[model samples]
Structures are given as C-alpha cells and as structure tokens.
Target chain A: MGIEFQNVNKTYPDGTVAVDQFSLHVPSHTSTVLLGSSGCGKTTLLRMVNRMVDPSSGAVLIDDEDVAGVEPVALRRRIGYVMQNSGLLPHRRVIDNIATVSRLNGVAKAAAHRRAHELMETVGLDSALAQRYPGQLSGGQQQRVGVARGLAADPNILLMDEPFGAVDPLVRLELQRELTRIQSELHKTIIFVTHDIDEALTLGDQIVVLKKGGEVAQIGTPQQIVESPADDFVAQFLGLDSARRTLSAAPRDDGGWFVSDAQGRPLGVVDSLPQHPGQNA
Target chain B: MAWILDHLPRILELSLAHLLLAAPAIAAAFLVAVPIAWAANRVRPLREIVVSGTGLLYAVPSLPLFIVLPIILGTGVRDTLNVIVALTIFGLALMVRSAADALDSVDGGVRLASTAVGYSAALRFFTVELPLAGPALLAGLRVVSVSTISLVSVSAVLGVQSLGSLFTDGFERGIVPSIVAGIAFTAVLALLLDLLLVAAGRLTMPWVKGGRR
Candidate 1:
C-alpha cells in the first residue's frame, strides 16, 4: 500500500552517483513529491520505485515487499508513472493509448476499450477525441491523456516526473487542479518529481527537497517547508516569499499552529511539523 | 493511332503483364526490406554494414544482377522467374534504403512512451513503429513500383517478350504506332500505381495528413 526505500543508492555505469543511500517512506493515500534541480536525481528516485532504473545498492519496497524480487512488468503495472513529455504512442488512437496498461494486464479488447473511454471522460476529454491519434491533441490535452493512462490500472501508487512541465502555464495550472481533485477523490498514493518549487508547493502533500549532491535538503508539508525550513539549503531550494512563509510559524494561542483547510476547517494543531507529512491530515 | 484503338485488347494484355510483374516485385521487395531496415535501425554498427551492403546491391546493374542469378541458380535465362528475380533485386535495394529511413525517422518520444506503456520491442515494432513509418514505407514502395516497371522491361534482352520487345519490334519494322502504344501503356500503369500508393498512404497515415477531419 505504501512505498519504502531503504538506503538505496544508484551509481550509473559511468560511475556517477546520482542517488546516494537515499531512504524514505511514502505512506498510503498520500502525495509525496521529490523537488530538486535538474540532475539532482529526482527522476532517478521515482524510477527506482518501479524498477525502471534499478538501484545499485539497497532496497525499494512497495507494500512491504522488495521490488527487486518482483517481476519488472508486474511491479510497473502496480505503480503508475507519468513523464514530462506525454509519450503517447503516435500510431494508436487516443482511446487505445489510455488502455495501454489495462491491455497489458490482459484485459480483453472490448473491456479495455470500454475502460479507456471511461477514463477519457474522467480526465475531462471529449469522447470524440477517443478515435483520434495523440498527434491530433494539443500539448495540454496530451498530458490529460497521459494522466488518464497512468490511472488506467488503478495502481496503488502514482509516480509523476514533471508531468506538466511541457504544457503552457495556464494548462499546467488546470492539470494541477485536476490532479488535486483526483487525489482528493481517489486517495491514491503518489510520488511526484519536479524541479519547480512552485509546482512542488502546489501539488506536494509531503515535499522532499534534494540538493545538488543528492542529499536530502529537507522534507515537510508545503506550509512547513515554506515557513520553517530545516536549513539554508531548504530555504533556498523552496524559494518562497520569506514574509508570507513566516505566517504559519508566527506564535499561536495554544503554543501550536492551528492547521486549516483553505475553507477554514481546523484539521489539526501542530507544535512542530511532522518529520514526514501526509496529505489531508 | 488507328491501330492502337484497333488492337486495344492486346494493349490491355500487355498492360496486365506489366502490372503482374511489377506488383509482385514491389510486394516481395517490401517483405524483405522491412526486417533489414529494422536491423539497420537497432544496431549502430550493423547499420553501416547493412546500409552499405544494401547500397552495394543497389549499385549493381539490374541486367548484370539478373543475368548472374539465373546462371548461379542454374535457371534458364528466358524464364519469367528470371525477370521476377531481376526486378526484386532492383526493388529490394530501394525498399531497404527507404524503409530504414522511415524507421529512423519515427519520433523517439513515441518509442519511449510505447515502452513505458508496456509494449515489448516486438509489439512496438509491429504496432507503433511500422504504422508510424507507413508513409515513408509507402514512399519507398512507390519508388519500387515505378522502378520495377522500368527494370522489368529489360527481360527482353534474355529473349522474353515484354513491352520492351514491342518497342524493339516496332523500331525494326518502322511501326510508329506499336512503339507509341508500348510507351503509353507503361507510362499509364506507373501513374496508376503511384496514385494507388498515395491513396494507401493517406488511409494508413491519417495522423501524417494532419489528422484530417
């Protein structure tokens, strides 16, 4: 149900160490984002969850089982991943692209197509687009299809590597909001990777900041990350407006900050941020 | 012109033979070329070897290649099979080059996405790679079709009769109509074949045609 990385390290064949003994746990029904600059190993870390790129040392466990021992295809099928470029197969119809994972899982053609059409609707696409190929869609629409495809198999965990990085700013916001809505409803555990601090703050339930040398700069909720950074590296990496970020850390009546939803419903009282925060806590 | 109209059935028969010879050669070339092209695209070292090897095949004169095969295979020179052999060699070289170019041109993103979506290498080849490369392959096939028609005429040198023989006979007897008929028939057939290829390309590659409404 959750993903755990225990002292995982990745040294490329060229002997460059991208991830150095990194370890973390993403609890079920949460969105954990890996935020960093390019080459900080955020993407590599995400790929390790599904064994797209194997770690040189240590273990990646999904649902308490080491992924190394699982069949790569079966492991991947249970974890949905989205890349920056919505790598839609150019030759397939939009519907067929959405059904890729389901079909891979041995779903019959009729059932797979039916599920694909349903997912297209869930992702805010017109059913008419189902018959069209990926090339016919705009960049934003393509990313929507990518998201739809990722959710096709109902995986317990979703991994996205800058999924909206290629779309226009306006469309990117739309995708972010849609993802938020979907996460609220589906409660799928997600690990999103992005270099943009704004995207990190906007989408992350728990933000893991990676520094240039693949070190853990910080890990916290968006509010905690912005308001009370662990260090200068975290503060710089977050790049939030210092004054606004400080609002949540201002002294409170109960000697603890009262956390609230945007609608002002009190969620909890926190003396200090949890070492690892989960979404909608 | 009067004689051409008078013997339209014979003209039609000649046209049929031309189609029969060229179509099969193009089809055979297409079948052989795709695997060669796929190999060329996948293996970097093999790419040069395959390309140069196919290019060398292309460089060989059609008449000589055709002439040599029958002797090497111990088949008689006058057989239609020899003509098929010659046209296939000519068509295949073009096909290998064109198919390789087409496969190479497939967008890298598409291939990556296919892999991420759980398509194996073979599935990617058949479903994604081949379909996306359809237009290029068709373009190669078009060229092969045209080339086959032109090269198949050389069968006359081996003592088999074709439109080339009609031209030879007409020239020998000073009959201008027969020469004109041969020229017109071959030209018309090539034009029709190309048009058909264009249609097939459009149907197979609706995406390439800008995803027409």
Candidate 2:
C-alpha cells in the first residue's frame, strides 16, 4: 500500500467524533477516492497523512512507515495537498507560486523559476501567465496553477480536498479532466475527496465510501462497488440501480466483440453492438 | 512693512531649519515605528507590552520628554536626537497598533497556502503576510507621519525652533501675521504629508486598488 490508515480515530475537543476507527489502504500509483457528504470525515482523514491535523489515536503510514514519526512540515513537503479553493497566494505571481516549495527547500532562485516554467507548460497553462499574480487568473486557471504548484516538489503522493468544488460547473469539469490526465501520466498515489458521486466514479481507481462519523461504508472498484455493494448503506448511499450502472461498463464494440456471463467464458454475440463488415454477427 | 522686509531673509532661513527639523523627525519616527510594529506583530507577548509601553510614552507630554532627555542623556541634547526621540515616542504606539491589526487581518487562506507550499514561517511572513498587509501598514504609517508634523511644534517650546517656534514667537510678541504664517505653513505641510502618503500607498499597494477595481 502507498498509504494506509490503521485504526485511526479522531474526536474533537467538544467530544464529537469526526472520524471513527477508520482503516484503509491505498495501493501504489493509483487514485483512491474518499467519497461522502460534508462532515463524513473524508477531509479530516486526508489531513492526517501530512499531520496537518493529528489523529486522536492510531497511525497513518506511508509505505508502511508511520507518518507521525516524521516532522509535519517535512512530511507535508513530501506529499502535495490541494484545498477546495486552490489557495494560491495572491501576492505571488504564477511562476513564484509554483516555485514556492522548491524555493522553501533552498533550490537556487533561478532554478526554481525554471522548474515552475516547465511545470506551467506541463499543466497546459500559457507560459505568459507565469508573471501574473493569482488574482489575475480565472478560477480554472488558478486551480491549474495550484496543481502545478502541488506537483512542483515532485512528491510521491498527492492529497486533494474537493479541489474543484469552488469552480463553476464548466470550469470544474475542465479541471477534473486535467487532474485525471495528470494522474494517468504521473501515476502518483492520490487521495481525492469529493461529495459528488459522478466525480468519484470518474476519478477513483478505488472508491472508499465514507459514512458519517468516519466509518467506511464501502470500499471497492467502481464496478465492484456498484455490482456488489457491501451493505444497505452502500446501496442507499450510491442510490438504487447501481448494479445496472456497473454492468454497463462493457464497451460497445461491433460483432468483433461478444458478451459474456459472470465468468470469463463467452456466452453469445451482442445484438446491440455496432455492425462491422467481414465479421460474423 | 519695512521691518517685515528686513526680517524676510531670516524668516526664510528659520523656516528652512524648521522644515529640516520636522522632516528628519518624521522619517526617524517612521523608521523606528515600522520595525517595532513589525516585531510587535510577530511576537505576541511583545506586542501588548510594546504597544502599551509606547502608549504610556506618548501620554508623557512632549515638552517634558524633551526637557528630561537633556538631563538623562546629558545636557545639549539638541538637533537630531532630541527631535527624533520626541516624535518616535509620540508616534510609536499608533504605528505598532496599526501594524498588529494589519498583520492580524491578513487573509487566513494566504497563510495556509504558504504553509502548504512548504514555506518556512519567516519566508511566509516576509513574502506573503507582509505584502498582503501592506495597505493597513501604510495607513498606520500615514497616521504616524501626520501626528509627527503636528507634534513637532512642541519642540519649539524647547527653543529648538521649527514652524511651531514661529507660533511660539508670534504668541509671545502678540504679532498676528506671524501666527498666521506659522498656522499656514503647518497646515500646508500637513496636507502635503498626507498627499505623499496616499501616493506612496498607491505605488506600494497596487493589489488593493486593483482588487477594488
């Protein structure tokens, strides 16, 4: 596992349990999403990995090593974190914002700027925006800059807390697609938190459905989750008809492809498949 | 009219000296107050102590401060040190308070963003926190400069002779035009100082103006 929570529990000073004995594993080089409504403790769980908020009890491990042992600031640098609002420093230009982590680690000023420039290109932002401050950028553009900044330090893991939540729907979709592309190319272990089910289905390699008070309602791939929900909560949480949605995963290939039953064994050709010449229907 | 004509050259010379006196006093007060304010803002314990101490210092009449300084720092505490000390104490409390408020009001998100990006406490304060707090700090400084000009005439009571000294002379001699000239010069200087502050604020805090637009 790239990151794992071992019996972690957190109760606020007011005696409200934000997260209960939560334990889960995120596989290396894959995106594991924490999907829930507000107050589900998804955000609280994400913050524990970097020790921004310490767990009341239990351990957070990165590659089986306890994150508690590492200095919070040092641990944070090794893990990229993106908040809902993008959280760009208004006083810093695009290039400087991207270079913030590198500069903090004492990278030569010129080298940091160069790295920022390169990352800006990688994220598909115009290099010309490099000199502009955060206030000058659009919401989508700011989020792009935030992603580039997160990746600038080249951390092995990235944590996102409703990263696209603040943007309008159109911009939100664009950023989500961009993030998916970044994940595919980089293959960093990612923990994405979102309230939107569509966002979870689209982004998660493995989805962790969190119940209120931080219990794991369910954990599985999209197909496994929809097809074989762990409990009534999962069914209700994901809404009804999840099984049909899971079954719809098979691609609509022509008679070149055939449908199969639960087993890998082929049953029959799909009549709904698009027709192809020189092939048996 | 003949007497006024004869004294014009001396009046100009004295006026120049008074300008000289007020300018450095204001500059020195700002120099001392800004860092104190910045420091007070950075350290919590110091903030209350420094602000309260400067407040107490400000309440001590400027005439007594000037008079007592020569006795404590030794007699002949004329020119720069005397004027600077008076203005520095006079303005310090307000500057520190302003700076602390400004720093406190800095957007919480900016600080969090800086921390998440791995910026050290010092780097974040200097680059992000301080810049964002620029408008408030400048406003504080404007208050300090204006206060300095108004309080500077108190030095005239020590016979140090600035614009206030002219007022003192006019009051003692009961000459109406001299009092008029003193008030006129001081008012004009206050207005000019205020304008310069606004201009400086504009230049340094473009983000504020840009945000408003």
Best by TM-score: 1
Q: lDDT tens string, model 1, B98-179?
A: 9999999898877766666567778778988899889888888988898888777777666677666667777889999998
Evaluated against the true structure, the overall lDDT of model 2 is 0.81
Interface DockQ per candidate: 0.40, 0.37
Best candidate, DockQ-wise? 1
Tens digits of per-residue lDDT for model 2, A231-267: 9888877774443233321555453445654445555
lDDT of 1 by residue, A130-198 (tens): 988787899999999999999999888888989999999999999999999989989999999998888
Best by lDDT: 1
lDDT of 1: 0.83
Task: List residue ranges in candidate 1 displaced over 4 A.
Answer: A241-281, B210-213
Which residue pairs of candidate 1 clash?
none
Each model's total of backbone clashes:
0, 0
Residue B162 of model 2 has an lDDT of: 75
Per-candidate TM-score, chain A: 0.85, 0.86
